[model samples]
Target: QPVTEEPSALAPPAAKPKSAVFYRHLRLDFPAIVRGEGSYLILDDGRRILDASGGAAVACIGHSDARVGEAIMSQIKSASYCATLLYTSTVCEQLCRLLVDSTNGQMARAYIVCSGSEAMEASLKLARQYFLEKTQPEPQRTHFIARHQSYHGNTLGALAVGGHKSRRLPYEPILSTNVSHVSPCYAYRGKKAGESDAEYVVRLADELDAEFQRVGPEKVCAFVAEPVVGGALGAVPSVPGYFKAIQAVCRKYGALFICDEVMCGMGRTGSLHAWQQEEGVFPDIQTYGKCLGGGYQPIAGILASHEIIDTISKGSGAFVTGHTYQGHPVSCAAALAVQHIVAEENLLANVSELGPYLGELLTKRLGDHPYVGDIRGRGFFWGIELVEDKATARPFPPKANVAMEIIDLGLKGADYSVALYPGSGTADGVSGDHVILAPMFNASRAEIETIAD
Candidate 1:
């Protein structure tokens, strides 16, 4: 007689090999993405996932573009590395020129870096240094004012300036004390029941002004904000005249207005810079990344206004900060190629034409759903906020992990295959949830339909 086998249920699960890589979620196993084609990612298991969020709105042109790859290789063959202090490459100059030209002289200088965090860090340092270099130096100007529910980056300096509550919780003890927070221009939650757009703008602007006064206006260096907030608040755009009002407050205090376009700039909002869409709201120091390199290379930078650059040039004759990988040749080449493609292909036109359609589709599809609290965004970037109670706009508790759950299901569910960017703490920086849908700038109408569907 054959030996009787133990029941399958009685047998222990096979021991899997432990992964060597430290993941963001230690207990979860991530799917391996083998390659990308157009708007989809090909996983190792052979499933094609529609890249709806472009990997945090970075892949504006989509993945694996031959042109960008060629540019990167060409730059590598010529020169990949250089000491930024001792030398600067032609590619770096070209990239900087392209950025400054895009700003149409509003931004006079560009300082390249490896990520948005570095750009923001540089922006903060440059703001401080600018004050020190002024003809009448205000050494007392050590404070920075930023909006609540804002996310700049992960570096300590960036984190200190950021107001995302959950992201800052763990590092609160170490974050700088020089930064203070103000209310973000979130109409869905922040606006009063009977308030008009103009009224809301005034109220928020007054709050910012009061904060500056509270902090002692003369001691403030800058008022930092994202024209269209990204992860922290799920692609929330300020109402009309919001930026102008706030900029006035900054101007009144003689504080620089630093716009962080890390997730919403570079044609992601149908403008080279998000502030360009806001009338008379030019930033003194602007930080941009994400779509800057179109995910082909790791690159980011800050565009400084003429005043700040002139101040530094006259006083220090040099920026006080520097990074080892600043102005890396290959990264600059990749970014330059990406920006050129964006311009040559007229992808901004695509974004401008299709962005409203995408929004309309999302509203038609999910607007009535009890869970969809709000839908807001511009250009290729849009967000669907989820709520537990539509009547009250009540957010699910943090333990529910609603946003991540939806994202995980989208990735692994049998009915659909899509990748979305998730955000938490949307309601009060701890309980609200939202999912962003940021298709590539070159995404087709058909792809937009698929994403909305």
Candidate 2:
């Protein structure tokens, strides 16, 4: 009998490279990413594309970090798996503690989970559960009031709470009808010619107030919003006192305020939490992700305030939420390590110091461009809204795919090797275009200049 030889583990698999992967764009052939180093993505063809947007603003700490790798390895070698149903690992607890501490007691408890969508789903359920644990159990308070042009997540529950028309169109019939939309506090396009920030905020607040009244305030569970609107609105931050005014409406209606900071929080907006910069207003419940783990692992979690935690504690002594990998050791360890690096190196301070320069450079370079209509953001996250006519702020039609074209141009050749985050529907629900530039928090002045150039 002849001896049989097996395929070497080092060799590539026999199947077609792209066959097994279900990409976001099924019709397009995707580039193969071999590796990442610092703020650049290395392609299999030896191209080094600068990662300016950090893959939808996820990688805040950068691509390659030996510290995070070692921490993940150490956890894997010691104890990689632990069922949160039966037990909790120290790594998970530590990450939770760090998260809670980062909030400075404004948010009391942290429930660890996997992705931003998962975190948003958990938040929705938790909001409902909080109402149930009330003295009278206001179960009728199941409706959510969210802003228009917001993207919470793609999950069914999260989708229902978001108001992005294009994204919700396919599932509108199937999605829950309990959620309603109010106008977002968008200053650039929504504000009047002579409107001050205060007047704009008041007008938006009135819109929210009217929505709550129209929906029957007592029947609403919570008013959900992103402190700095991400994705759907292209990194648009609310005008001063906007959050406070909206939060007041929620309070007046005896409803909870759930802030979805999945994309804008975790120091992406120069502060660990975006709400911290919003007139000292703290949310009842906050969902966080993206830069939370700095793209080191699949980890996201919710931070519930003391008021919410106490309510559930007093009523049934239980909050109904569970996930099998809720507190996975390896994921927690990786996140913890990334956060530790963030703190030890003071990356948040770096964001604060260098963020203004990024904005200035973007304005200096792209401000007067024919296609640039608006440039707005805070911290290291900035968005450039592209338009066909800057004077009229007329967005190129969605059919043109202007946002994607800019991204394509940025990634074209070694001469223009840069990656940007593309988004649509910035002007309205269907025809706007914008691209975001969210570099690593630790990016130097030179790199920031390069990105701007």
Candidate 3:
């Protein structure tokens, strides 16, 4: 029942997709989402679809959150926007305070913005300024190390550092040449046949070290990576001791470790930050988005540790970057409210409790399916890899479009609507394929069961 753009003989009965206005199919034909309640999105025609992917895993508290709405409305009633440069609003200050408290003061500052890409950009600029202010201004220290098959953002700078070859291909001629990529710690694909977990972690750490050394240790500013691989590689978690080892290497070379938790952080992985869940590992700089504002008003920001901020404050008095919409009041207040409700209701507790059961249910429902190759994730984030053969883990050719097929069936025939967050080249940035599913944090067990089944 999966609809393909290709011509096929055995297609199911359905309305033809209507013409889109903005872009092509890969560009648009997405339904006009009319309204949402709980985990369900009502389309313009009134078809209720389960929001399994939570609109790119952004709506953590789900739609119809009265508290978040009320908080935003209250802020709007007074003032909707306030430029952080001249006037500092109480909402922005309180939000920063909350974020700092969440990290137990290890985080010294938060730079808020209107989108995830903006947050990532601010993080990079902030890191650059931090070193300059400290008088360690090594202009050559502009290089960064990232992993393959990972997605950070769409802006040229962030996209340049990202590993998704397909997304970066068109912009290669113009992308910054300061980035070098190493292998991601995708155990299912990157692990050797006879190697132990410790060995694999060491290998990846060693790769990072070599990259830093190749780029010149003094020139490498930071190593950026997602704590748990999202987007491009599905919901892959690194091997045990992976982040610790990587952190050690980065520290040995005096490079900052920037964790891009735009997808996996903010209670999506049972902990407020995914890096917090890792043993003896925390990032020097961190970026969060998506659930930070629960997809309410488009908000995100960078959190810097006290060490980084002190170095900057003592060195330079002002950040070099400028954005008119940075630290907009309504977005910050909405995010604060979402964070508050998440705490007051103890929704993270549910994410932890329901996550394991959902995993089990997924395995129970699809374990025996011939095409399912790998099922992996943590907390509410999950991914299913489909292959031509499960034993060999050989993915279907792009021409076959296995993920699209399964997703189409899951959406239409299954009487459920879900966003198909799949990745091509999940194995090596070119070949492996997978579908990611991240349900809302406040989702009911029964609703989760229905969605899973």
Worst 10 residues of 2 by lDDT: 1-10
How much is 198 displaced in model 1, in angstroms? 0.1
* Residue-by-residue lDDT tens digits, candidate 1, 243-343: 99999999998999999999999999998899999999899999999899988889999999999999889887999899899999999999999999999
- Once fitted onto the true fold, the runs of candidate 3 whose alpha carbons sit more than 4 angstroms away are 1-28, 135-138, 418-420, 426-431
Q: Candidate 3, residues 23-123: lDDT per residue as tens digits?
A: 53665466566567777776654456677888677888888788888998999999888976799899999998888788865688888888778778888
TM-score of 3: 0.92
lDDT of 2 by residue, 277-385 (tens): 9986989999998897889899888999899989888888877888888878999999999888888899999999999899999999889999999999999889899
Top-scoring candidate (lDDT)? 1
After best superposition, candidate 3 residue 375: deviation in angstroms? Answer: 0.7
Ranking by lDDT: 1, 2, 3
The segments of candidate 2 whose C-alpha lies over 4 angstroms from its true place after superposition are: 1-18, 135-138, 426-431
Per-candidate TM-score against the hidden true structure: 0.95, 0.95, 0.92
User: Which residue window of length 10 is worst by lDDT in model 3?
Assistant: 1-10
Residue 397 accuracy (lDDT) in model 2: 81
Q: How many residue pairs of model 2 clash at the backbone? A: 0
